[model samples]
Target: MRAADPALDSLQGLALGDAFGDRWFSVPIDELSDALAVRTLRPAPWPWTDDTAMALVLVRHLITWGEVRQDALAGDFAAEYGREYHRDYGPAMHRVLRGIGSGGDWRAITSSQFEGHGSYGNGAAMRVAPLGAWFADDLDETVRQAELQALTTHFHPEAVAGAVAVALAAALAVRTRGRRAPGRAELLTEIAGRLPDSEVRSGLRIAARMPDRTSVRHAAAVLGSGLLISAPDTVPFALWSAAGHLDSLPEAIWHTVAGGGDTDTTCAIAAGVVAARTGLADVPPAWLAAREELPDWVAEVSTSS
Candidate 1:
């Protein structure tokens, strides 16, 4: 219970962005296009998906342990997944979580994914911002904790890199909260420098070079927008959006969703990272009202030590 405020802000932004982006999938293609052009507001009670679901578990894990204990984190993930399996989890995750719930070892369950190549999914990246916020004062520890949490399910190096990048982004956001963060190039350069050699790192480097005036469609096409449900396809553009809109959670999300691929996860990643810096300060009332409420357990834990 040490300064849960920023972490809670990140969680709220994550869940809100998840719900907001998920809502776009329900509209007709023509309507969606028109809506995007005008930035139409969606109806109330926007529901979140597995992105928010998994993030809740992550925040709760951080609340309970204040650091990653992989075995315990795995158990909690399985238990949560067992209770709710309809949150739009990918096929690989279903198998891994089911196996873990059946008392299988976390390593064995995760290692079995993709015929032992393991998963490179964005699930890890999408849910890690609060952890970064939690350990903002110690970025090395943030990377360590982020990797440990990611290895519970997403075992690929790309996925680990994705989590590391996102966590470091959030930590940096916290470190610079309430102030002007570094410029886009400097911010992305710093993030990319911390990552291991991987597609995620390469993408961040490319993002660093891209001009800020670039259109969202062009940017998403270049950096990718989670089309593959993989970390490399998602993290960079999400981070780019975050770097540009660190002062506004809703703006970061709008830019993310405009990319039009795996929006819930992308928005979740971007909003979580942005909110780690901006908190809920710039969230519009309508956006806040449209998002579904977080689980009561999250509130309970936020209030607890």
Candidate 2:
């Protein structure tokens, strides 16, 4: 189990998860509609969705700044986002970005969301795996930087919790790649210690108890899937998938998408963390070919960084 380059591994994982999860929408109706019943992927080109796009934004920020600069990242997010205009942007996030586009203060826009609690959406969790991989050698710093990045728009506790879980998961995966991968107990303990008290933490505690469920179908039932799309609901499913399939990026992502809720994000989180440790060697070549092409800036940033 030789470790791969963290950046390359993380990038591939994020891309694969994004592309695989995007199958629900990009695939033919017959294929997607039948995926749940079959529990098998059709041989098709995977086209990633918003999850990959936002992730590229974060990777670009890290490559350019070396650390997350709140203002700069926020501006980059606003610019890169809203381009599709039809992608599934959360209502609160959409409002925040719209405000930024209209010359409103980023802080003001974020602060005004969710009745001043700010957004607790899984948006932060969706894109944070790369940050964790970037700081894998330093778990504490991984949590710190994840917080700095998440606060750009997601100021709520659950959002922060979700980001923390993803960051710590990425760090654990990278740190343990060459050795035995962390088991569910160790993984959860590390993440729980880094995170403060929250429902997300509680859900993780629950996830650690169900490691052998070995199926996203069962895990999501216990973990609430991502239909709620909050940190508690979404993060647990990702953690469960990551823990159960720690060494297999494709299987982890498959489990996530199989959960049937917030497929892109759950898969993104699972892919990002697992891939950081396992690398792209395990990803199907066809899936990579099918994914949306990375932006030139995103590529330049990851490579240069």
- What tens digits encode model 1's per-residue C-alpha lDDT throughout 58-93? 888887777899999999999999988999999999
Among all windows of 10 consecutive residues in model 2, the one with the lowest summed lDDT is 1-10
Number of clashes recorded per candidate: 0, 0
Q: Kindly give the stretch of ten consecutive residues in candidate 1 with the minimal lDDT sum.
A: 24-33
Q: TM per model?
A: 0.96, 0.90
Candidate 2, residues 176-219: lDDT per residue as tens digits? 87888878777886787778899889888888877474566677
Model 2's TM-score against the true structure: 0.90
Candidate 1 backbone collisions, by pair = none
Total residue pair clashes for candidate 2:
0
- Please list the Cα RMSD from the true structure of every candidate, rounded to 1 decimal place: 1.5, 3.2
> In TM-score terms, which candidate is top?
1
